[model samples]
Target: MPNRQAGISFCDGPKEREGREGRPAVNLRTLKYFVAIADAGSLTAAAEAIAIAQPALSRQMHALEEEMGVPLLQRTARGVRLTQAGVTLYEAAQRMLDEAQRVKRQLAGPSEAGESRVVLGVSPTLSRVLVPGLFERCHRTMDQMRLTVREAFTPELLDMLEKGMVDMAIITSMGASADRPLALHPLVGEPFALATPRSMKMDPIISLAALSRIPLLMTTLHRTVVERQLRPMGVHLNIHSEIDSVDAIRELVHDGDWCTLMPVSVFKEARSDAGITLTEVSGVQLNRQLMMATRIEAVPSTAVAALREIVLAELARLNRLRVFNFGKKPVKR
Candidate 1:
């Protein structure tokens, strides 16, 4: 038997508890209120996020506290804090709420309409090149399907796909093993280029050998390529600084003060945006394979098919555009 003194009861809600009559329909709202109170460190901020009035949020919190027979939130002059009991339950409430929303979306979507929702991931590296245009094209092609996209690093996206968070991912990867459990569709190869600021106003590109004395901005790729390519050419670079972001490296290059060797996909956009130029080093070319990777197709959801088609179409369009000169002789892997 349950302890009556602990406030435990099967019918947890407002109004009549002994009978369903006059009882307000209660569910996870109480758990959500407890979460809000804990995060806001007070009732107000949490209430705002939850779109409930502060006092109402407080009331929900109080009801939840009473149901648990434990004070979930502690009030002090500074505001509110979660009690030890509240902290433990809040973590569980979060996962429950997320799964509930996931189920709700599945139920609300039409089952017979052949319209399904697909969630996919794109690496930030590719987002810069494809995002705006991809959105326009997907709408025209898959009007019935609801498409969703998320951006993260390749490793992060891979984790999401493995964890069933996303259906597929478009990314740049180097030699993902064949034994790995994934389906990879080959896309155009992303090549490398040596970009320099347009402000230099240099003549029609000369051999990379001639520009060896120039100060190239060091990016991660330089270590991968230039150390091998440049040393042999007798080029002595006064590398300006080691930076990470393609955008930042572009700024340094576009300013006419620095140069860097980078993959052409990144170089392509940075060149257009920052008014920079990339020339094949006249000796070395490096390209990373770009592709769409997915787990084995699920129960044939239309949304999944639509998303896969759109992604494939995008890859096709890029290939047709010949934007990266993938036709250039393949570099030795």
Candidate 2:
């Protein structure tokens, strides 16, 4: 019998080693060895990186090349080099190795892990309220969650979620929809509030165009702010500036002579400044149902469920505080 290889036992598949297939039977271990060799440009260096013996690695590499049914490396006196075929195969093999590693990591992490890596999209509108509280709760509950957060408008976030690029997203209330492979779970209901400087005397129920000259600090979602707060009186308001930061809006309203229509959450933030008041909208009342959304088939990790529970608990606590007046400077737009 031909001299059997020592490291040949490492190969997982057994069809007489590529028997009848005419191709070398390859496995994950071989792919990793191949990538390491290509990267280091030498078997000795690759073996050092992977903590395997050079001779053992060489045997496996030789077995892999045989399975491939083609000469892969150009082993010249200078060093080992890959032929064109090896280069092409290495590129594809590298991707497979990377994907396999990701799978392994995903599995090893939290079987019921909230720590599973996820790319999450957040709406700027909801971020104004949920960001701080969410972070606090994430730290407290979902210790394993590795979150990559991106802030965008509702339309953009929803688009990313629909594209299956993001794991899940938190978007503003755009009405209920089960058509887009998205399942919405309503969390909080945000009512429109007038965020304005305290010095300005605002009517309990005011119509638009009353302050046609006043500057409007608005986000991209300003339309919802307007239609809900001012459209009842047929007020066609001119938006002076469309901005992103609710904090900046509060600052402009506090320092300069600007007023904006915002949500109750911004009102919560502005309470500290003593210069802004978040007043109930009297003209047209609208509430956005803030929701947590994920793919219809997604199973929430234990960490995600725990985090959600913490958020809901916080929301419940805040709901109770809504009744008690915390005498702070008020900002009502």
Candidate 3:
């Protein structure tokens, strides 16, 4: 009051200077408004789209520009055009909005009447045997639930889970190490068996040494698993064809001349003439751990929990049936 301007210099206080120099604070709602303005190309259109008064929208835009310490838009008689800084922010805002929408959808849970939607990813090999039965079981048990099954490889399925695209996955563990951010529940440890045409002359039990002599049609993706198990035993596989498709490999093996190594579950399918026969491989037990994978941060919904239980129960039942030739040993829950 004695001398108002005597002590208060323009940049005397740190807080006052900080307000002028610091970066602007932006939130999702502000970003949304900016995006609307950018898309509409004018305050009038943006205000109309957002159902806000033009004056209020203009005031908000002025405040944003002042806080940012930059001119974001160039006013025009017809409409508005974004400055360079505004263009950069617009692109970033668009991406943020897209991710926000995805997260919202994921968190929205189900719809009315306790009806839920669950997405399950399964390997192509497993999907052949599991999808139809799983679908039927899901529909029968949870009449209000909708289940979507996606068939993909282990790596692809893992990616889908991490991105929140799939709710759960049945995948084969590549090694002892488990992926972080994913919860792995071991469903079964399945041993590899020699699958040959029923007409092929082979022993009911084959040695790793004897397996090297057979012409094998195997998936190229499983070569690493095969080598890891066979190299220690000094047995080298003579792979005839490296096929990626499970159906193609099965068909090629069913030709009676080519044999393939697969999980015992693959041979359980009923066949008339060109049937497959599975023989236990002695000498070295090459086991693949089948795991139920879900995101570590995700808590399963009621429908998802029911689906998981159904899958585990079915796997246990299949194990008890000795479909994987585990000798009456049920899979550990």
Candidate 4:
């Protein structure tokens, strides 16, 4: 049977319980110390890192090995290395510690100051379009919340979410990945468009085939998403420059005859500009789905829920104003 504590359940499976009847019980603090030692690669280093005495750290590790009835670490002249059993326990302890921290946060709920802290991640492409409205709404309505925004591309954002660095992320959804057990909520579907200099005599629409011949500058992130969809059907982009910065790409496109392929929402501010012409690309349903992702194991705090609601509402408002042409139906991933 699993032991329930503070609304969290922990169970010792058959494999875990198969060992001895007489052993010291390992707790979270000990597991944390073990992890630190493993990460530090030396007991002295671990002790310094965790602010514990060297003797105490050594005793803890010895007791831990005895509890598991296996030598967790092989002490060498220089430092220490994990035994096979230690590797297994290290992996399990990491997961257990992560779960414990998450539960502790959940139990704590809002801060003592009555402010909800939420770390949000947004892709650079969407940050400009979303942040202003989000901040305004939060100030006007959600006054009791402290919001921290991290702006990065899709890949970096996903990595941040997995590491628990960000509470939630709005990113270009590449569907589910087996390695990342995240809960994704589809937010919007945005179509791709081409931004060309006004001097170039072109129609409002261009085919994917014609686009292949035209010289274009593209950001690395957008290129990855667009090419993943277009490449299979014998389509390739004429990417003359692979720049990761959107602003730099836009500046280059404006100064030269170069064009860039990006999500339509990315060029919302430049749509009516006299120097730039935003055109829709045809011959392919080239678009990216935006989704909100959180760790699957997370229990949404009041602040997290509030932040989500505010984001959805902000996107809805932008859609209504035709700021960006959002699809009528958001495709669920």
Candidate 5:
């Protein structure tokens, strides 16, 4: 009978026991599960992300720990934390999995002869300004490449990138964590502006003090960035609502008295709209850095690099057109 451990069966034949020159056999699938668990910080989340049952994932992990003869995970009240051994294994497995993907891609060849696909992720606000130009440029210049665009919030984009669902993402500096396995390329600096209906009769610029008193609606991500910088200075925002949807916020801002703070590029195209006006906020540095984020482990293929350059070129075109007063000195009271 095959030796079984925690619902996992392993062949007990002489060669299987010896496991390729007296070393324990390593299952690439189990290693992938371990990596997913490490990335997600919990077995439940990892299972959900990969669409496996939690009990089965747990059994696999348990069998892996038993086979390795070392504790890999430490269960905590909040979730699971990797032990020292787990950390070492996680890092190595990450590299191995990345290499395996590279080898697989090499074997499968490009989607077409001399052609490959690259998936890019961007936020809703940035998408409005970047996507149309990006698509146009890719069509004209990157004829051998296929491009797919995904729109989501910063955290969601990060998740997608980590899962290899996106080859690259246009992420804000606020969301790029120092510890993530990502390589960041600076794209542009975007400044936040106070958006209001033109009927509000507000100044072209408002001080931070006055800005704090007004009720505002903001996305959760934007609010976090704002508060992290302002709360320590004794200034607090009177947030009327925290709506994550950009369209919803725009509709509410344009049809009502509530104003919202967001990157200038978000509404740059709507400058000619008679219903709303974008006011610069004074006495605060609301400059947001935009970055091109890619996985540190995966080497960029030729198509990926070409797509990246096209994105940069499109951004340069937007900058030349003054899409959003980028790099300008902040307004003063």
Candidate 6:
């Protein structure tokens, strides 16, 4: 079982549990030293890089190998070469060090007198519409807060949230049950729409059957969502192109007669463009839940809390304006 309070999953691997048999425990500092040496190819160089004595670096490596009961390195005239075991240990050590740094960043608090910094992850589908307003709001109201925005796909954002690389993320539902490590706060159910060239003669609300007859460009990531919702109703996607970038999809639909199916959020900024028009899907109410996800183990800083408030307020404002054709009003929780 994971340590819920600390958010650390205990490993039961034999190498991880080697200390159970009265062996000296291997520490992260030691792993860091070993990785440094492995990367530098010489203890003398590694020690200088890490600001440690060369002999001390050697001693730590010796102790680490002893703890694991394996010979990890072989001395060479030019430098040191990793043995088979050394290669394995080095890979694992590198991952551990990276994860450690990520955790440290996640747990770091604002300085005593400086501006608080917060990292927010936004899914690619919503970044274009959400980021500019979010950044402007933070700059106008929260002078003491600094924000870093990372735009990625929903799966990538979820992974970053899990690894403590991001403080909070806005992601679309993938139809999976909620994960224990994450606290999901529902924002809205954004409805899907048909994006067509402005010149195309289309109904005010296009049905799945009507969309199927048109050549379509759909996002590969969101295809699953459409499949899940429409496949059961015997509607199949007639995808002409599988593009990942929303901007690319929009450009394609704008330049050609091809139409694409996507969330109305994608067309929010481009609604005024004479090249494209958006119509809600009619036969099926295809939508995905948009939610804010934060690590369950995280203790939010003042900046993070403030940013959350700003985001929720902005989302509510957008909801009131019917900006993205959210299927229903967001319920206050």
Highest TM-score: which candidate? 6
Poorly placed runs, candidate 5 (over 4 Å): 1-108, 270-272, 297-299, 326-333
Model 3 misplaced regions, further than 4 Å: 1-109, 175-177, 272-274, 326-333
Highest-lDDT candidate: 5
Can you tell me which runs of candidate 6 are displaced by over 4 Å?
Answer: 1-109, 270-272, 326-333
C-alpha RMSD of each candidate structure in angstroms: 9.2, 12.7, 13.4, 10.2, 9.4, 9.2
Q: In model 4, which runs have C-alpha deviations exceeding 4 angstroms?
A: 1-111, 175-178, 270-272, 326-333
2 against 5, candidate with superior TM-score: 5
Model 2 spans > 4 angstroms off: 1-115, 118-120, 175-178, 203-205, 208-214, 228-233, 270-273, 323-333
Clashes of each: 0, 14, 0, 0, 0, 0
Which ten contiguous residues of candidate 2 have the minimum total lDDT? Answer: 1-10
The lDDT of model 1 is 0.65
Instruction: Write model 6 residue lDDT over 132-237, tens digit each, in one string.
Output: 8889999999989878888888887887778776788988886324654788898988888887887876667877777777778888878888888888889888
- Each prediction's Cα lDDT score? 0.65, 0.66, 0.75, 0.79, 0.81, 0.77
Pairwise TM-score winner, candidates 4 and 6: 6
**Better model by lDDT, 4 or 5?**
5
Summing lDDT over every window of 10 consecutive residues in candidate 4, give the lowest-scoring window.
1-10
- Give the Å error, residue 250, model 4: 1.9
Root mean square deviation (Cα) for candidate 3: 13.4
Error of 3 at 56 (Å): 40
lDDT by residue (197-283, candidate 5, tens digit) is: 888888888999999999999999999998988877889999999999987888788785679998877776644256767788887
> TM-scores of the models, in the given order?
0.60, 0.56, 0.64, 0.64, 0.66, 0.66
**Candidate 2 local accuracy as lDDT?**
0.66
